[model samples]
Target: MRKVMFAMNISIDGCHEHTHFNPGEDLMDYFTGLMQDTGVIVYGRKTYELMVPFWPEVAKNRTGRPCDVAFADAMTRIEKIVLSRTLENADETTRIVRGDPEGLIRELKQQPGEKIAFSSTSLLPRLLEAGLIDELYLIVHPVLVGENKRLFDNFLVPEKLNYRLEYTRLFKSGAMALHYQKSE
Candidate 1:
């Protein structure tokens, strides 16, 4: 069975907004590798809307930072599963799932693949609460936004979740990529 990984960019103070911090080359490369290995990328409606138009265009026109372009190209090629109640349609290559998002995700995890990469912070809490997340990969940025959405704001676990620290890499920009596997 494939593992479900929550790959998110978070601030020192736990903000999840991408606009809150800048990702350097190393960071982009790290994510690009992730996007390449991901068999299916899952997103919430808001995150889907935010990414749909931009990355695919970058894949076509090949504009922006080299790392960004590469990441975008990889993103364009990955399969996308969008969880939404109101979203009627999505990209031609993407699948729009209405109810039972968690069940659908479980089925995806059981399927033969590299891994299911979750790209939406909005759905993180729900997924984590369900004990569906196999790995938590957080690219912790250096900046601290005193006011903003909390990274684990939506997380509501019945009990404390324990994870084993797999590894950590410190980037030149002072950001660190922390990788952890959920404890059995």
Candidate 2:
């Protein structure tokens, strides 16, 4: 069976609340590695917009230090499907798909290839409610905020995860990489 990896950058208190996209280098390297292994990448609408513009152009003419270069490079080849009601078009490599979101995911799980889903907090909750996720890779960050998106806040159902500690790493910037496998 293919694994659906829910990799994200969250707070130290298990809160994914963030003001803006500031995923660190360690986290980027880690996910980029996983994304390299994955043949397909599924992302939420917000995530798509945040990530799409920086790709394949080496941070889109931004001077100085490169941000997520591996991620930009890897994203060019990996097939991406962005789930959005508002997004009308995608670039040459990607396809903008509109439909009942979960219904589409349910169908993808039955097909072939190693698939991975990025920070679709909205969709992840639904998948958990449906008991469909096979694996999850979450990266815990250091900061916390007053108003931002929390991964499980909008989740409708409670899930008891039988997970295994796959890997753990501490970054110099006071971040932690917490990898969990849904054992059940």
Candidate 3:
């Protein structure tokens, strides 16, 4: 079965606002590498809006640093699945999927794919609670956002979920990328 990986960047204090953290070239490069193994990326409407036009535009314009441009290119090329009932349309590389997001994800996992990646904070709790995520990647940045949406504020699992640390990578910007797999 393909792995369902939930990856996100969070602040030291558990804030999940992407803009709160400053990811350097190394971090961007690392994410770009992660994209290489991902066949489909899943996002909630909010994240989709934040990532779409911006990254695709960046890829087309070849803007930002070399690493950023490369990451943008990779992001634009990869297939994206957005789970939103209200979203009406998306770009060519993106598919807007509605009705039972969890069921759709389970079906996607059974299909042939490299990895099903998830990057939406709004959907994290639901995925975790449903035990749909096979792996988790948390890039902890070395900063604190006093007030914002927290990482696990709404996380409520029926039973305690256990995860085994698979690996970790420390970036030059003092950010740490932690990879964890669900303990079988």
Which pairs of residues have clashing backbones in candidate 2? none
Q: Candidate 3 — which residues are off by over 4 angstroms?
A: none
**59 Cα displacement, candidate 1 (Å):** 0.5
- Tell me the whole-model lDDT of each prediction, alpha carbons only: 0.88, 0.72, 0.91
Tens-digit per-residue lDDT, 1-184, candidate 1: 8999888888989988889878889999998987877989888899999899889989899999999999998899989989899998897999998878789888998799888988677777788888899998998998888887998887778999999999999988999999999999
Output the worst ten-in-a-row residue range by lDDT, candidate 3. 118-127
How much lDDT does candidate 2 score?
Answer: 0.72
Best candidate (score: TM-score): 3
What TM-score fits each model? 0.96, 0.84, 0.97
lDDT of each residue in 63-112, candidate 2, tens digit only: 32443666777666788889888887776777777877777677777788
Return the top candidate by lDDT.
3
- Candidate 2, residue 77: the lDDT equals 78
Ranking of all predicted structures according to lDDT, beginning with the best and ending with the worst: 3, 1, 2
Model 2: number of backbone collisions: 0
